[model samples]
Target: MKIAYFDNNATTRIDDLVLEAMLPYLKEQYGNASSVQHKLGRQGSHAVEHARIQVAELIHANPKEITFTSGSTEAINTVLRGISKSYRTIGNRILTCGTEHKAVLTTCEQLTKEGMAIDLLKVNGLGEIDLQALEDAIGPETVLVCLMAANNETGVIHPLQEIAEICQRKGVLFFCDATQWIGKLPLNVEETPIDILCLSAHKMHGPKGIGALYIRRKSKPIQIPALISGGKQEHGLRGGTYPVHQIVGLGEAAHQAQQKFEIATLRDYFEAELLKAVEESSIPTKGANRLPNTSNVLIKHVKTAELMTKLPQVAFSSGSACVSGDRDPSHVLKAMGYSAEDAYCSMRFSFSKYTDREEVDSAIQQLKEAVAAIRAHSPIWEMYKDGLI
Candidate 1:
């Protein structure tokens, strides 16, 4: 069976061009970037700096502000931990929402144990926080505001410009997780007033285990301490030997995504056809501005796990790939006012530039068949049809 992949939001297949760019660094160019005394080492160092410039140009950021990390997880930890400590004397409070990624949510939760006040702003049914509520929440004790450019599961986009303005006017630092937003959408850090941001390469068709954190240095300088302590690397912010090959892959991927083709046309067609074929199916966040390549479909009464088990030819997700092993309902949907049953019945389908209409049609047919098969055996589905629930 030919498999159809709709899980690009979880992680994308590395582009061939990115892999080709990284080949030499993994083989002949294996010299350490920290070793500048030798010729090969200096060459490797130059390659790393070149890759940094490539990644920086993609987001219109200063190359000096970029700091490489293992992935967005590490970058998030570094920012949250470092800033919370650095600004502890200025303020004891951090503002964020419950619908954020686990990395941000978990780190903020942990900071509460260290005497930091963590306030979670509520999201509406559309997974959007009230701008007025956000502005009102910023007290003198608030040090930082954490938000994401786009949600990982639903792909609903937050108002970055407005949020940045709010944080700027309040004199609090704004940290955005652009992990799922950067490659899919255009971002100009110089135009926006964000204090810090994070992005992972794997989400944009690059190699895994390499990402970057953007720190504001010129306008409103932020003094954040190092998360990892050791040798001088990443401007003494993150220490250790650099992964030159992976960094090269990330840079190449960024270059490709900069010129990626339009994807919303395919995504819209997929959603329209699927909704027409599948009974009572609807998109939960249709009214919100979402990523062009993502659609979270709610197939009432058909469980996502059962749908996946029945149809193995298509790859999709119930929620974030990081917590796929957990059987609990999606926290994101739950935050959007969905019940556990509704959350269980929702499936996330994400696309990429490589995705074609034929693959989407095939996946839609498989989904229609699988959903019908599962709902046929469900007593709850029968009740829903009879209006007895």
Candidate 2:
């Protein structure tokens, strides 16, 4: 069976160009980036620095501002841990929204155990943060405001600019997890006043296990002690031997993404095709201003897991890939005011520039068949049809 992949949000296939760019580093150029005397080490360091330039160019940031990491989760954890440790004397209070990924929520929970206060900002029914509530949440004791540029589950883009402005007015450092938004959407860090931003390489057709964090340079240079204590690396913020090949892959991927990011037309075609196939039922698209490549739809009367099982040829996800096994409904949908049932019935379909119109059509047909088959067996659908339980 030919498999149709619509789960780019979870992870993307590595681009051929990116792989090609990384071949030398993985094969002949293998050396420790920390080694200064050897030629091999210089080659590795050169590759890392070159990759840094690519990542920086993608976000319109200075290469000096980027710090390499394992992935978005680690980058986020680093920022959270670093900020909390550095600002604990002034304030131990952290603010985040209810719709954040497990990484952010779990990290905040860990901090709470260590005697820090955390405030979860509530969102409206559309999965948007309450701006007034965010404003009210920030106080002198608030040190950091954590938010995501786009939600992983719903594809809903947050009002980051407004939130950033709010944090700036309150003098609180703002951190944004731009993991889902970086490659799919256009971003300018300088224009958008953000203190810390996180990104992952795999989501943008780069190698897995490589990511970057953007730290705003301040007049006094806000220093957060190293997360991993070892040889000095990543400007002494993260101390470990760098992955040269993976960094090269990330850089190549970022360069490619910058060159070929035409998500709007492709996304529109997919959405139109899906709506055409399922005109009677509602397709739960994110509210205006979402990532162009994402589509979150609720197939009523069909369980998401059941649908997935029936449609084995297509690759999709019920929610964020990171929260796959949890029985609880998606916190993102819940924050959007979706009921438990609505959240459970929802499926996330994400596309990439590599996705074609034929693939979109194939996915729609498979989804329609899967929904029909599953709902036919569902007692809930039968009862609704006969008006009897």
Among these predictions, the greatest lDDT belongs to: 1
Best by TM-score: 1
Clashing pairs in 1: none
Off by over 4 Å in 1: none
**Candidate 2 collision pairs:** none
The clash tally of candidate 2 reads 0
Q: What CA root-mean-square deviation does each model show from the true structure? A: 1.0, 1.6
Q: What TM-score would candidate 2 get against the native?
A: 0.96
Model 1, residue 143: C-alpha shift (Å) = 0.4
CA displacement after TM-score superposition, residue 2 of candidate 1 (Å): 1.7
TM-score against truth, every candidate: 0.98, 0.96
Which ranges in model 2 have alpha carbons more than 4 Å from their true place?
387-389
